[model samples]
Target chain A: MMQIVKPDFEFKKVYETLYPVIFRVAYRVTGDRALAEDLSHEAFIKYYERRNPLPDLKQTKYWLIRVVKNIALNYEKKKLREKKAYDKLQFKYPHFTQSGEAEFIKEETKSFVQKALNKLPYNLRIVLVLKEYAGLNYKEIGSILGIREGNVKIRVFRARERLGKIIDSDAI
Target chain B: MCPDNETLSAYFDNEIPSPWNKRIADHIAECASCQKRLRQFETIKNYLHEDREPSFESSLEQLEIRLAGLKPRTERVSLWKRRVAVPLPAAVIAAICIMILGISLIFSLTRSNLRTMSIRRGPSGTTEVQVAAPIEDLELLLKSLDTYYLKQEIIITLPEDSLFNITGEAMMFREAEFSRKRE
Candidate 1:
């Protein structure tokens, strides 16, 4: 008899295995702990509901990271659509600014950083997030993103250059 | 002379080739602007490394409970299909077949002589006995048997010498019982 394995068995095991990595990835992208937790939960639920096959832990982590990135991007787009000022950098660095003008300047600086991070296309964002957020090395990121290590290095370099320009412009 | 961005990035990443690595170090030492840029990259690295880990502790219990509550649909279906439905099905089928066959044989013997015959003239005006056994629609017959009384016999009676297709005979009795059960 050909037996059909219940998808939930695989789902539970996969969630247990990849949850931490997914949570961390979401946190890095969204820059909010609670939202990251929720996003990771939602991602797992969505993956489970799709009857996704249980991949090896590494692949699952990569998939989870990708899902979190797409979701966070959509969220940012939605904020932009809503025309909320804080939406530009909704998760700002909590370090306080003393003067009102200084606070506005800091806010603008953060906004510039957010906009730059958002502008770097999915290709660069994936590499940058893998390197800076998930802390994956070039080889690991190359495998996850299906690119050469050299390509990964170049992409990260370009991303950092763009980010530096954005921050430097705001400082001026 | 200062190194380019790519070389500087590689130098910062600690992946530069030996001679180029030494060259970038020499440039950083000689050039204040390049040194400041190197410090900036170092700051970026520190900020990245200083990222706080997110906590999922509050949601863990709920997530676990939900996951636990999610009984795989195949498992439930399989449990019923295998544990309950499989073991005694053959026996049930056997019992049903036997009961149907016995009742059909008894009924057939009682009504065997009541079959009607008909004759029709063709173009040649020939006469023939068209002996036709009236075949009851089993489904319809079973549907109408609600009015009839059933003895509910413990032991089924069978003829001493029976020769016929047992399947058809069993079907007849099964139909009759099904009809009676509707009442």
Candidate 2:
């Protein structure tokens, strides 16, 4: 018989508390508001589905946020998969100038640090987001990302340094 | 020497372990170059933290709708799937090892169907083990020792059907007897 483990905490309470934090993390990591919302919901749905293999409710907040990050990573892979299809679509529809001012304007409309953040590779950006937004220590970030604590520290610093450099260039 | 960028960054995060933390703190306090580096990091930290919050009320409403629709996905994991998930190579290797061990054990058992062991005295007056000999031969030797019992030499109290008496071990016991005779 397949056993299902149900935690003591109410699902609604967990949702209400964690939903916003996960959304923010997904947003910061993916740099797309819509994608962030979708990822957050998907993560919640997945965590809900895991009633058969329930995660510890005490660590649910962190688990939810990490799932958000992972969902963003999956989106990156999806983007890679669609790259060829996108190229073909671009070739077939030359009138579709996605490289035009509208896209650039949308980027410029984003916040300065967010624009700088969007420029960073997702791995570096997610580490920074988890540290700053989630208020996670290097060890916590490392545990979530399956990286060494020391590597987490280095990535966070390099991310900050790169972000600073980008902002400086944008200012110039 | 000034710590590398990574170490300084770790120091900035207070992620550096102590002794090093104390040392770096002292160094950053004293060193002009490190102070400038630290100030740059502080500026970046402030900029990252000082963000305007976007209105996520609409997103939250959409999330509520999604959450309302979401049902717990029933995952019926079968025992067959679990059994298959275990690596086949490891299982095959274990089976091979067990088979090899069984075969060797069978061969050793089949080899041990001998009657008795032929124990002969070496040139150094120690008994060496050889092939099987008759139990009657051992009984004859013991009976001779009974006839030649000058004092309490070789006090063997084995039963009539006790030729394979392993308690009277071959080499070490023979060496002890030889030493007693020399004394």
Candidate 3:
């Protein structure tokens, strides 16, 4: 693993190639395009700063995936807290648009699959997205999440099974 | 013998090792329970990897904007770590700070080049660096030191009424000698 400490390192090519893949994993995990974009941008920024520490180009990409997943997880927690505060606000100060519950129900119908995916626990959801969308193997995902390869396999399987059950239950 | 659920799932991804991989393949071929589980795994993997990630054009645009505007690696990371909105306010503040610091560094480095420095010896004979910089440079240094200010109080007593005694004696002398001369 030769050190790549070049003053003119070409990071643009890597960014272009990796953005789509990282974005998909983040989007799949969080189920929001805007949030995913933020998460993806954050991961790339982190990679830009820490690219030298990684041993090689391949490790750098893996490091990007790992950082993206962790950032997404942290983003999810922060978003959850914001949502709780928002719900409390809504309860205290009841403001409703003419959009109404019926319109909300209609909108929910359109994103049923997404809602189901969001329902899956974050740990399972993260492993599933990284494996399926990020296209990382068990060892790679394990290295990212700091878990065992066997555990990664089991989580991925459980995530898929739970997703299938949810989809079947909803018949969407 | 039946493999564990994790091992069976690993087979779908072909994560099983050498001898175990062959054994699982042979076992799944003959065993109905493992075969059923394998089918379930396949069904789920197919559904879970469904291509549902929404497309956003903003990804590349945002990246381009950042790459175009990147000033320096250290400053970029510091600004970004504090906030991800990528606002220019922090960058502006950071640039101002760096400019100030650079000027200070240059000032210190060029200290030896100054033709004259008025050194004031304090009570202990230690010299104080009252820098004789250009007015603009001095103002800049003063502005940078705006935060730390010290306050003090002092009292001064004025000599009062000692002149009254002298004035009284002079009047007495005038009344005695000068009055007689005038008369």
Candidate 4:
């Protein structure tokens, strides 16, 4: 008799296959390893928690992308709240010791590129990472981000343009 | 008119048709500003394309260990059921934690209401007095009294002849005073 496999085991296999990609995407989005792992795990848990199975791998990927995006957005909001609190405390007391070491790395062109990318709006970061690191085409990124393909293309192009200017300045 | 930004973008992407591509290329070549812009775009693209991957094999081992800590010991079974099982408890636990945290916060805010009551023997009757403090501190005080006296138990002999009204959050000791005699 053919043994019946459990849905949970099948779900684990699927998660294992996709976990690496999801981790990379989450890491790029959150810019923190621990946060990336947390977001990825949360995405997986949410994905599996649904009573109905996902329609297909394509849909699953889309769900993962959306979940991670929301998680990263919430994390950003929390960070902003914490920053505001810290600033308020510092302004009031002004006697606390600042944490961590300050180091100056070499002045490389890559630093300029990084600075330029950071200067872009968060929406632009989403588009660029989706296209650049995840290697999703314009239409796929659009579907993932719920924007029109033309919008995705336009944003990415603008991001690249801004980045190019910064890079060229550093190069010269 | 100068070529539109989309056309310029298309030219950067190498997506414009051949004749249009040549036209844009010639325009960019002649225009130092546009040439610089194009070169800048190329540089950004190069930086973006540069591989910045962490060593996944090493990361994967760490992930494996982290996952193992949370993995259930059950053999291969319905993943669908397993997936459903996982988040339900997480949500439930989160709700429970929120409830506990909220209660603690409320308690901390209103802790001044916590009270302690003492009964002392008097000539005509027992007099009951109250002071405010944490229940845990009250219990600790009682426990220490028992230990210091080295008695099998500390019996508060209430004379049942005086009327006393005490209002406090932790009035359970009054009930305990009544309960001990019955026992």
Identify the leading candidate in terms of lDDT.
Answer: 2
DockQ of candidate 3, scored on C-alphas against the true complex (2 decimals): 0.15
Best candidate, DockQ: 2
TM-score of chain B taken alone, candidate 4: 0.30
- Cα-based lDDT at residue B68, candidate 1: 57
Model 3, A26-56: lDDT tens digits are 7778777777888888887776666344556
Rank candidates, TM-score, best first.
2, 3, 4, 1
Model 2 CAPRI rating: acceptable
Interface RMSD of each: 5.9, 3.8, 7.6, 6.7
lDDT of 1 by residue, B1-183 (tens): 777776687678876878879878987888998888788887666645554453666666567766556645332233345543455889889899999888987886775532333433333445443434332344452233333413321222222343333444554456457667866
Report, for every candidate in turn, its global Cα lDDT versus the true structure.
Answer: 0.63, 0.74, 0.69, 0.65
Shift in Å, residue B132, candidate 3? 60
lDDT tens string, model 2, A82-113?
Answer: 77777788899977665669768777677887
Q: How far does residue A80 in candidate 1 sit from its true spot (Å)?
A: 1.9
Candidate 4 ranges beyond 4 A from true positions: A1-13, A102-116, A165-172, B10-36, B58-183
Clashes of 3: 0
What pairs collide in candidate 2?
none
lDDT of 4 by residue, B1-183 (tens): 357665676577655678888888888878877777677666667876674644345555565565556533334445454544357789999899999878877765665544544544343434444434444354565666567655343444333333222323334566456556655
